[model samples]
Target: MDRRQFLELSGAAGGTLLLGSSAAAEATPAVATTNHPKPVGAVTYYTEIRVPPPEKAAVLAKMDELIALMQGKAGYLSLSFKQTIGESTMGRAYPNPKKAILAEALATLDGTLSSPKVPYFYVMFLRFDNYDNLLASGVQAWFKANIVPSLFAYNAATTPPTKTSIALDFHEGVYTTVAAADRVNGYMTAEEISTYLASKQSDEVAGQYVSVNNHYMIMDVNREAHYNLLRENLNGNTRSIFRPIPGDAGYDDSDPDYVANGQPAAADNTFFRKAVTREILQNAFPEGEKRNYLMHGVWETIMDHENSHLDPRFSAGASQVGSYFIAHPVEPFYITLKQDRFIKSA
Candidate 1:
């Protein structure tokens, strides 16, 4: 759909409305292309859902049900659900309150306020085998029949057992993965950062993991020349690189073997078809300082629908590096990007 149509569908007027029969008639979208020499095949559906504070639990339950229904579906790979943590400091991270789904839902419930936070609460990432299946009519039909009813059901009766008004905000888009990188520990050191930038000039790396603070850096020289321009400045920045423990193995002071080989698995380097959406959450420290003491595992799932069509040389594993710094006190916000890649299976 075009930008205008997408805005309306995600707006207050259309937020709570079901996809209905019309969605089943939507023509499948064309596969997106990238500047890369080879074509990629995976597709993703990234959705953002907003619910009132009181309805958070209920909405999540409904969402879980929807996810369960999607299990074992043709071309379906994996689905992840993440919630935004901490209060929003910026004024309306989702602006245009009049056009927001949550705002309109609240107004309908008679629970509207002058300045509601409009919880940009949940983010769902659904991966599929290809763009065609991602937009298939069967999928749309299933949502209309099962998912929509549970989410938008509102009760008008209130005599003995009053039913609360159902309010929700939803926005979604299809995306193809283009490029990704992962760092084992936290952020890269000042020296490592310099090496990374310099290597990109002579390498074909689609993307590179900088630090937990910077996360994955998309390597587009024309679009992101700042990486090269600010190389000198990056060298002086002293943010500690935060690395979580690898697995269930607890940290030990005297275990020499544990100290020698306790790092997590290295991530695979992969590229995608297009860059759909880039979400950067700076600080979602839900666990506070204690979170730092726990081990954190970071991995990427890179898949291509038409894996046979691509060259095998591009599927090589990633290189390793040593830990650079200690974990920062403030939990680092995650950087999530929606992109597509070609893989052998879902």
Candidate 2:
């Protein structure tokens, strides 16, 4: 199915509406690409859901039921349900609230540190073997049938439930795993990753030990060149500053530059993936066509990620690409609460 058809099946909207605003919702979508490379990587449905405290249990129960239905589907790979643990404290060292509005939002809805007055946010990743399977997963159908009512139905007597979806927002997009790597594994293909998963026991396969960190930034559609350049250069900078030498347990602590460059004292084992082809609800600050880019990384511990921000090289790279950011970059850590994988034996 084409992009429009896919959207029709899934109620994925391009702009977020204020809680009760009736103003026309406008989305400045990135111009479609012409003669782009054929998509040839694992695709995922990345969804974000905001749930009120009272509805959390109900939402999770529905999620469990949904997982059961997905297990037997064709080309189904894995499903991960993640809970937001905290935001990046290290990021605070840099200038923030690039926009005044963001500062106000954070001040009122600061869910990262203490009690949150706003709804809790959760992230779900539904992976498939390829783009076709992702488009045909039928998850949207299941959600429409089973999950939609729970969000909107409060009073049984009312014809349309007399209430709106309890969840504050649902933001989602189709994303492709464009790049992935680890120091020991080096780089893995989709088949190789399947083999790797097959070798792991259930606990490791579920990713019980590591923390998943999501780094989000906004990129102007017209500045594709700048985005490409940042990706290329940032990859090199992160690898040099963070990744340990292959086969080595950790970085040489004796090197004076190690601590200075923000390398943690402990062994650094991090897996990184460059996920592309996803967009988030747009805002006015971008001032042009824009897309959201997620830099996903798995770290041994949250501190391993937090300490990396001390590196001056990272700051320099950020300044170089600062203009592309329409909003302040947000990095948050998540814990896997529920996960399941279907791996063919190697």
Per-prediction TM-score:
0.37, 0.61
Best by lDDT: 2
lDDT of each: 0.30, 0.47
Tens digit of per-residue lDDT, candidate 2, span 1-346 = 2333223322223312111111122111112235233345556666665554445677788889878877767777777787665566555454322211221232233433223224555677677666566656787666555544444323334443244433343545555553343433322355644333222213422444334433334545544566455555445544455533334455555765543342442323332122111111221123234444555555545555554554465567656766665444555556667777556333
Weakest ten-residue segment in model 2 by summed lDDT: 17-26
- lDDT minimum window of 10 residues, candidate 1: 316-325
Model 2: lDDT to the true structure? 0.47
lDDT of 1 by residue, 1-346 (tens): 2323322432324322111112223322223345222223554565444544334555566656756655546665555554433211111223322111221122233323322334334445566655566665255555445433333323323233222445343444454433222222212343332222222111111342111212111223222232232322222111111111233234443644334322222222122121111112111111111111111112111111111012132111111100211221111122232212222243
Q: What TM-score does structure 1 among the candidates reach?
A: 0.37
